[model samples]
Target: MHRTPTRRQIQAKLSTMPPQRSQATAYLNAYKMMLEKERLEEELDKLEVRRHQIQQRLAILNSQTIPEGDMTHQQANTNLEDNTPKFKTLTLEY
Candidate 1:
């Protein structure tokens, strides 16, 4: 986002700066970087929320087994039992 300098900022830089740093380029760059940092932190927060939702969905699916009347119930149950423990261990670790 390109931002035009506010009146206060321009006044502060033009009239109140010390002789050695008269240009104020460093201060302006620092402000820009601060804005960029805020944008990235917001993005990270959104990604974390999505990741948590996916993990919860995985846990719910892991807890279910095929019904007893299904043709492949035995095979499905064995697969679920084998994989569910791994998911549980990972869930606890996280």
Candidate 2:
């Protein structure tokens, strides 16, 4: 099976390359890393926005008053617990 090269193997290969080629390779890798960093930053911004939206939604839900009188606080709490929205777990990968 094919496998990724180790850091030592990569360094050895780079050392054998001409200086200009080595420098070009380094520059290309740095450019790619910068692109990746920007992409990750944008993703983080989107996630933060989504988090804030969810928090606002939760606050609105919490602020809503259950009708008072007929039911005791414990009963209202139980009803809220029973009706609470269920969320599926999500797995994220880089």
Candidate 3:
């Protein structure tokens, strides 16, 4: 029984071909471009994953409260101080 050649076998045959043939040059160029495209796609996938992680981290930070340790003593004291109005009320006669 005869079996069809695999993709790797076809690629091997193309690689060993002399550069003098225009058809071989085209095939080689195509092969190189395909490899480069695959590499770029993989890099894009990595960057997408990193972007998602950063977004998740941002969401988590937004949902949580700021710890006291992250604030200066003055800031902590200011927040703890009373925020009630201290201005005297002026009565205006109509």
Candidate 4:
């Protein structure tokens, strides 16, 4: 004759099952990594927005036209001279 397991016996058997230690550890690590990735992505997005704003400001400044009465020919010539590049030539004879 066989007897059915009582409530206490069933509870004891369930308690004896192995804990999912490795699986739990892996899940926690993955969750931390995901959070770090999200934070970095948000930081990158903020930097991109700042870059766009700076570029727009630069474009506006570059496109502004100087009034003819305000700029003198001598000043323009000075500006050109300052911006002109000086080149040196190196000749190699082998």
Note the Cα lDDT for every prediction shown. 0.69, 0.73, 0.75, 0.72
Model 4 per-residue lDDT tens digits across residues 1-94: 8898665521211334455679886796677678777887999999999999999998877666444434676687888889756787899999
Q: Which regions of candidate 3 deviate over 4 angstroms? A: 1-21, 66-94
Of candidates 4 and 2, the better by lDDT: 2
TM-score of 2: 0.49
The regions of model 2 sitting more than 4 angstroms off are 1-21, 65-94
Span of 10 residues, lowest total lDDT, candidate 2: 8-17
Tens digit of lDDT per residue, candidate 1, span 3-93?
A: 9876652222243745455457778767867977788799999999999999998877765533434647777788878864554333455
- Stretches of candidate 1 exceeding 4 Å from the true structure: 1-23, 65-71, 74-94
Question: How high a TM-score does candidate 3 get?
Answer: 0.50
The superposed Cα distance between candidate 2 and the true structure at residue 94, in angstroms, equals 78
After the best TM-score superposition of candidate 3, give how far the Cα of residue 51 lies from its true spot, in angstroms. 0.3
Top candidate, metric lDDT = 3
lDDT tens digits, residue span 40-72, model 3: 799999999999999999988866635544566
Error of 1 at 41 (Å): 0.6
What are the per-model C-alpha RMSD values against the true structure?
A: 17.8, 18.6, 14.4, 22.9
Q: Give the C-alpha lDDT of model 1.
A: 0.69
